[model samples]
Structure formats: structure tokens, C-alpha cells
Target chain A: MPRADARANRAALLASAAQRFAIDGADVALEKIARDAGVSIATLYRHFPHREALVAATYAREIEDLAEVPDDGSGSVALARWLLRFVEFARTKRALGDLLHAPGADHPPARGVLLDALDRILTRGRADGTLRDDRDPADVLALLAGLWTLPDDDTWPVRADRLAGFVLDGLTTTR
Target chain B: MPRADARANRAALLASAAQRFAIDGADVALEKIARDAGVSIATLYRHFPHREALVAATYAREIEDLAEVPDDGSGSVALARWLLRFVEFARTKRALGDLLHAPGADHPPARGVLLDALDRILTRGRADGTLRDDRDPADVLALLAGLWTLPDDDTWPVRADRLAGFVLDGLTTTR
Candidate 1:
């Protein structure tokens, strides 16, 4: 396959893997993921040599997604958007928890990446006076740790949204 | 022993149990607790038949503390004080988690009590125009769930305080 085609196939496989793993759990079949990604099992295996490889790759992509902040012109808006994305990331992370925490899982530095992302948004917000300067990004992140503790049920998304709103309100300056 | 003396001894045992459990784990020696409470082993046993009983009683007392909101005149101040007390409760709850979650352990209705306490404060705050009327007490409780997710260390108190501050700021009305 050409390099571009291979890259596209790889990205497709990762997206499928993330969705399937979240819905079906870490033990989800590789063939199902390949089928969902519109690729052959051989192609999936070529991109990811093993199940752990696929999981690690999916997790890395999620972190990268979080690190890429959307510039909405206003710091508060950007941070708010980023926080909603973080909620999605948190949901996926919870689904991947058992596998991620399994012994010796090699993945990117998720905490550092998330903190860097928050710092970026906070820095911009502070400069624009849209966010409170007294709040630390680390503290904001720590407060959000509640996302992991929420019950996984039909109401999960609503609860997650409310939690994010609370954090956002706390971070934003009173204008 | 007289009724008043028995009551004082029981309260002393509970206080010592809460302090010791926070410092030590759930399996800490009962003898140490009895000594700390200045009561004999028989007296401790009289109040609490078993270790589970003691843990349950301690948890009950913690919930009661949370339910008893301080009338600081301002609803925000009252809730703020209650929240600080809540941090302490969360810490003890974390320490007592294993015993509390053990099979068939009976305890008071913690969630109902906490929600009722929050409702009381929020009602006053909303009436006095000190807190945001748009916020739900349940959502506030859910947001404060982050308290349970924090790491237990020296910095735990500081992080807990920050988390409480964030929730309080989100719940309080802007003047």
C-alpha cells in the first residue's frame, strides 16, 4: 500500500477501535474493529501487532485530541469547548481503565498532556481576562477528577456535562 | 455506670475512633481506641458490639455533622463551613471505605442526609439572594463528589479545600 493509504487506514482503525472498545469493552474482538474501520483483519494486524498496541494507540490519540485546543478567540469559550472534549476523553478513559492500568501498559504521558492543554487554555484566558488568574490549572484538573467517579449509566452524560459546567463556571471570571 | 457517664463514654469512643481511623487504617487496634477514649474494653464493647458497629457509628456521626449546617447568617457562609466539614467527612469515609462497603454492613441513609443538608443551605441562600438559584443541590453534591477522588496525602487537605472552593464559587451568586 502507498504511504498515504496506509496512514488513512491506520487512522480509521484507531477511530473504530476507540468506539468499539468504549461500547464493547477492552476484550472487544479485533475482527469487529477492522470491519468497522472498513479494513481487513490483516491490515489491522499490520498496523497494530497486538491488542495492547491498539489500545495504547487509541489512548495516545485521545490524549492528542485533548492537547489540540480549539481557538475560539475567547479564552473562556476555548476552555469550555476543551472541557466538553475532556468529558468525552474521560468517558473513553473510564471504559479503557482496566486495560490501561494493567501491568506495564506503554502509553503517552496523559496527565502531562492534559495539564499542558489546560495550561494553554488558562494562559490564553488569563491574558484575555476571561478566566480567573487565581485558579491553577492543576487544581482545575484535580477538581475534574470527579469525572472518573461518576456512575456509568444512562445519566452519565448529563452528570458529566453538569460537572464540566461547574468547573467551567469556577474557572471563568465574573465579567 | 450512670446514663450520662455512659453517653460521654460512647461519644468519647466515637471521637477516638474517628481520629484513629483517619490516622490509621480500619484494622487499627480496638485496645488503642479504648485507651484513647479513656474507657475500658468492656465499655467500648458495651457501646459497639463489634468493629463494624464502631465503624458504622463513626460514619453515622460524620453524616450527622454534615447534616447539621452552621447558621452563619449568610447562606454562603453556612454552606462554606458545611463544605469544609464535608472535606473531613470525605477523608474519614475514604479511610473507612473497606468496612463500610463490606457485605451486609448497615448504615444510615448518607445520601439522603447530605442532600437534605444541601437543600437547607441552598434554600436559605436562594431566599437570601446569596447563592445562585439556578444551581441544583443534587448537582452541587455530584460536583463535590470530586472530593472522594483526591489522593490521600498531606496535600489532600489543600486539594480538598480547593475543590470545595470551586464548588462554592460555582454555587454562590455574584453580587
Candidate 2:
């Protein structure tokens, strides 16, 4: 295969691996994943040294890239919008969240980067009078944990949004 | 031993077993339980034929008697007080909750009776204009699941109460 083609294949494999792992859990076999990705097992192994590497890379890819935080909105509204997006992420990323929380799991790649992103959004919200100055990012994270407590029913999104709104209310004093 | 003394010893043994299981989980040994309760192993076995039986009895006993809900207050206030008490019960009776939730565990003893008691409280609140008329008890239980998501710090009770208030707000429709 051409060098560029191989790199593209590797990227495709990584993306597919993440989706499969998120949908089917950690025990999903590499053969099935490679097959689904339209690549061979040998190619999968060449790109990822092992299952953990693939899992970590997939998770790193799954986390939202923070370079897109809006620079031109009221901070509180932007923070609320950001938290709503995060709640959606937590609800849909259940499999990734489970992996990150599993006992004795390896650290996901670029965890610091993710935390830094969250910190930046929160700090900007506080500085701009959008978010309450008294709240910690950790507390906000803890409240967001409630998003994952959603039931598997038709009303899940509605209920999760309501709970997220409550959290937002608790975070801000003036709102 | 006298019959009354024998009954007292049996009661003490079960209480100790409940405390141990709640604090240490289901894996605690009978011998250790007997030692804690100052009872003989044979006596413990006489009262409870197996760990499952012991677990069941422990759960049943903890929930069999709850403090009476005051009839004089508005339904919402009454419901709030009742939920606080229930949350306290959950805090102290962690083992019962664990047994009920453990995968593949047998049906918990007297769950129907306990659930019925809870339903009555909610129904009374609804009838008396304390709780929202349309809220389902099942949804209340699901939302209460968020309580366990609280972080294990000294602030847990305070945070848990706030979460309960958030759910109560959703359950009510003041507007």
C-alpha cells in the first residue's frame, strides 16, 4: 500500500475501533474491529501496538476538542451551552465513561489536555460574570455525573436536560 | 438461657450482621459477625440458615418500621420531610440497598411491603397537595438514584440534600 494510504487506513481503523468499543465494550475482538474497519488484523496491529493503545487513542479522539469555545457570547449562556453539550457527550459516551472509570484502567492519552480545556471554559465563564465565581470545576464535574444517571427510556433526554438545568441553577446565584 | 434472653441474643446477632454487611459488604464471615454481636456461631445459624437469609432479614428489619409522616403539614413539605428521612435510611442501610442491587441476587425480602409503604407516603402527599399530582413513584426512585452519585466527602449529605431538592422541584409544578 502507498504510505499515505496506510496512514489513512490507520486513521480509519482508529475511528472504527472507538465506535465499536463504545458500542460493544472492551471485549470486542480485534478481528471483528478490523473487519468492520475494512482493514486486516495485521494492519490493525501495525497501527496500534495493542488493545489498550487503540482504546486510549479512541477515547482521546472521542473527547471534544476545546479549541472551539466561542469567544463572543455572554459567558453564562456560553457556559450553559457548553455544559449542555457536555451532558450530551456524557450521555452518548457511556461506553467511554465506563472504560475511564473501570478499576485499574490505564490512563487515557492527554487527560491533562481535557482537564485544561474544561478549566479554561469554566475560568472564562467566571471572569466574564457568566458563571458564579464561587464554584469549582470539580464540583461542576460532580454535578455533571448526574447526566449519566439517565434512564433508558424515551424521556431520558428531557429528564437529563432538566437535571442539567438544575445543576446550572445551583452553580449560578443570579440566574 | 432463658427464652427471652435467647430471643434477645438472636435479635442482637441479626442487628450486628446488618451493621457489618452494610459497613463491610456481603463477604463478611459468620464467625466475625457472631464475635461482633457477642453471640455463639450456632445461635447465629439458628436465626439465619444462610448468608442470603441473613441479608434478607437484615434488610427487612431495617425498613419494616419507619417514623410516622406528620399529617398536619402541606404535602410538599411533608414529602420533603419524608424524603429526607428516607435518605437518612438509605445512608444508614447501605447494605440493604447493596443486596437489593447486586446482580444475580435473589429477590429482597419484603420489597413489596416496603415499596407499598413508600407509595402510601407519596400518595398521601399527592392527595393533600404536597406533591405534584401526576408524578410517578418509579420516577422518584430513579431520580433518587442520583443521590448515590454524591462524592464521599463531609459535604456529601449537604450535596445530596441539594440533589433531592432539585428532584423535588421537578416533581412539583408551581407555575
Candidate 3:
């Protein structure tokens, strides 16, 4: 098989596996993922030697690109940008939420990408007098952790907007 | 048994049940709760009628008097008062967290009590121009939902304080 075709097949399998993992959780069958990806089982095995490798790699790919999500400036604008990203990921992340939070599990890749992004923006906001000095980025992250409980349906967007707006105001609105 | 003695037994059972509920969750066994109360199993059944009845009544009695927790004048002071009440209840309430959030569960008796208290103070703050108009009491309550996830240990008090303070600042801070 051509190298380019092999690479395309690997990408297809990851995409398919990601959806299955998100929906069916971490234990979905490899054969099912291969069928969904429209790739042979042999190709899935070639790309991922073990099930954990497959799950972790697919999950990492989902969040890896977020490391580059630009901060649209600072203060509320930057905070707002990062929050939307967080909310979006959280919406889909709930399907695999157990895995993400599993105790003693290996720390997932791309873990700090979003939190670091938030730290940068919050640091800028603090310097500019737009953000309060006492708030911690970790606390803000914990506050956002509640977002995981929100329902995944039409009303989710509205609820997410309310939560994100509240957090944003809490951090950026100074007395 | 005399009426006064029965009342005393009931009060003692509730105190034991409340402490166990906070530490062990809403599902702690009635027999265990009875032992802690130093009361007989027959007496617990007589007073509560059933396990659910005991759980509900005990939990209700915990937050029941919150109706009278004084709302100091207005603004941050009043907001702070209500938040402390909220954090304290949330600490124990986590025991019944599943029931509180269960889909289609009748809105728990305690659901709107704290929200209404928050609304009262926030309304006062807005009217007096000491609080931001853009904030909502329900939104603050949602942020406080994160309080349930904090670990059960010494740090809980400190973490709750931080979360409560963040929500207060979010509401009270003027830009």
C-alpha cells in the first residue's frame, strides 16, 4: 500500500474511533471502529497496537489543536474566547467524561493546552486592571468544571452561554 | 413514651443522621443512623415511618431554618451571608446530590430556597447600585454547583471559601 493511502486510512480510523469512544465510552470494540472508519481491521491494528493506544491517541487528536487557539486580546475578550473553546470541548467531552476523570489513569495528553491558554489571558487581564488580582486560574477552571453536568441538547447552548458569561464577568469585572 | 421524650429522641436522631449524611452521603443506612443516635431501630422506624421519610425529613430540617438566616442590609455583606449558608448546605447536600439532580425528580424542597435568598440580596444590591445588573442569581447558583465536586477533606472549607468569594466578586464587583 502507498504511504499516503496508509496515512489517510490512519486518520479515518482515528476520526471514527473518536466518535465511537465519545458515544459508547472507552470499551467499544476495535472491529466496530474499523467498520465505521471504512477501513480493514488489519489497518486499525497497524495504526494502534492496543486499545488504550487507540483511545488515548484519538482523544488527544481531538484536543491537540486547541493549544493554538489564539487569545483574541485580553481581559473579557480573551477570557470570552477561551471560555467558548472550553464550553465546546466540554459538550463533546462528556461522552468520555469518565475516562478523562478516571483516577490513576495516565495523565492525558493536551491536558494543559486550554488551562495554559487561560492563564496567559488572565495574566494579561490582571496587568491591565481589567481583571481582579485575587482570582486564580485554577479556581476559574474548577468553576467551569460544573459545565460538565449541563445537558447535551438544544438548551445546552443557552445554558453554556449563561455559565460562561457568569464566569467571565466574575473574573473580568473589577470593583 | 411521653411527648417531650419522644421529641427529644427525634431531635437526637436527626442530629446523628445529619452528621452521617454529610460524611457518608444520603444513602447511609437507617440502622447505622439509629445506632449513632443511641436510639432503638424500632424507635427510628416509629419516628420516620421509613428510610426515605427519615432521609427527607432530616435533610429538610437541615436547610429548613435557612428561611430565617438574616439578610444583612445589602450588597456584598448580604451576598456573603447567603453564600456561607449555601456552602454549608452544599457540603451536606452532596450526600443527596444524585437525588437532587436526578432527571424528572420533583424539584427538591431546598431547590429554590437558596436561589430566592440570593435573589433577594442581589435585587437589593442592584437597586442600590452596589452590584452589577448583568448578573443573575440562578447563574451564581450554577457556578456554586462546582462546590459539590471538591474533595471531602480539610481543604473543603478553604475551597468552598474560594468558590464563594469568586461568585461574590462576580456579582458585586463594579466595572
Q: What are the RMSD figures for all models against the true structure?
A: 9.3, 7.7, 7.2
Query: Per-residue lDDT for B1-175 in model 3, tens only?
Result: 5699899999999999888987777768888999999999999999988665666677786556664556567677777887888788777577645434322224555655655767777888888887888767656766776676565667778988999888877677564
lDDT (C-alpha) at residue A109 in model 2:
47
Sort all candidates by lDDT, best to worst: 1, 3, 2
Error of 3 at A39 (Å): 17
**Which runs in model 1 stand beyond 4 Å of their true positions?**
A1-58, A96-108, B1-58, B96-108
Model 2 residue-pair collision total? 3
Best-matching candidate per TM-score: 3
Worst 10-residue lDDT window, candidate 3 chain B: B97-106
Worst 10 residues of 3 chain A by lDDT: A98-107
- Model 1, range A1-175, lDDT digits (tens) per residue? 5699999999999999889987887778999999999999999999999886788788886667778987768899998898888888777676544332221223335555677888999999999999989877767776666565555677778878888888887788864
Error of 2 at B28 (Å): 7.8
Question: What TM-score, computed on C-alpha atoms, does each candidate reach?
Answer: 0.64, 0.58, 0.65
Q: What is the lDDT of candidate 2?
A: 0.65
TM for candidate 3 is 0.65
Per-residue CA lDDT of model 2 for A1-175, tens digit only, reads 6699898888899878878876775668999999988999999998888876787677665465532577677666766887777767666665554343321223344433555555777788788776667555544554455455454557767767766676676555463
Best by DockQ: 3
For candidate 2, lDDT tens digit of each residue in B2-120? 59988898789887987798778567888999999998899888888887778777766556665355667666776677678777876666555434332222335554455565577
Interface RMS for model 2: 6.1
Give the better candidate number (1 or 2) by lDDT: 1
Two-chain DockQ for model 2: 0.12
